[model samples]
Target: MIRADIDPKVGGHFLVIDRRPTGDAVHYGVFLELRRPRRMVFCFSAAEHDHNADRIQIDIEPLAEGTRLTLSHEMCSEWGQFEEQTRQGWVHVMQGLERELDAMQVVSVPEIVAQVAGEPSKASAP
Candidate 1:
């Protein structure tokens, strides 16, 4: 991402600008839920496709070795043509999250936001 303006509290808003190979992509959304260490739900959409905004839900579960993050994105039917692209985007994002977690050894809202914004998180283990 090129830049990010985020407020992670429930009902808060976020704006993220990503620099892709093709061009710059802008995404913005509002936080719907923020159950720390458990789940988060937010409205997600590109600036151009804001009319078809989708809700993305992330569920975090603890495991013996580590944590498992399950993501569900309920996209609008209007984005059918971009379905594959969207799926790839999610995959790429998850991969990035994994990389960030590996580097920071933590997973939280602030760290996640930092990861997406291409910044190293200052968050430490609690």
Candidate 2:
């Protein structure tokens, strides 16, 4: 669930509520610090273990050929052990993004370019 301004500004806020995959609990947060078209930061939490909530930041950059996406998670040392698991999750998300883009005829991902041993699809790049 999200409730916010139709056009978000720097001080705008949004609430996100989602059910955990296991359906054992709910996760939610208020995301603010918006920088239009470039960055946004949010905190993610599951009700039972609020201490583990992390500040998640997403940055988007326009490249010469396509767009670059970077994700960062800020958490305490207690969550350090889950780093690799977090990375794998991001990988899955990116692959899903690639497929969604494909369906929309959007840009190809870096992984696909590597697979072809060549440049990305022209239509998909720009």
lDDT of each: 0.71, 0.55
Predicted model with the maximum lDDT: 1
Error of 1 at 76 (Å): 0.8
Reference-based lDDT, residue 112, model 2:
29
Measured by TM-score, the strongest candidate is: 1
Error of 2 at 32 (Å): 2.4
Cα deviation of 87 in candidate 1 (Å)? 1.0
TM-score of 1: 0.78
**Residue by residue across 53-94, what tens digits does model 1's lDDT show?**
777778877755666677777766666667668777877887
- Model 2 lowest lDDT segment of ten: 117-126
C-alpha displacement of 60 in model 1, angstroms?
0.2
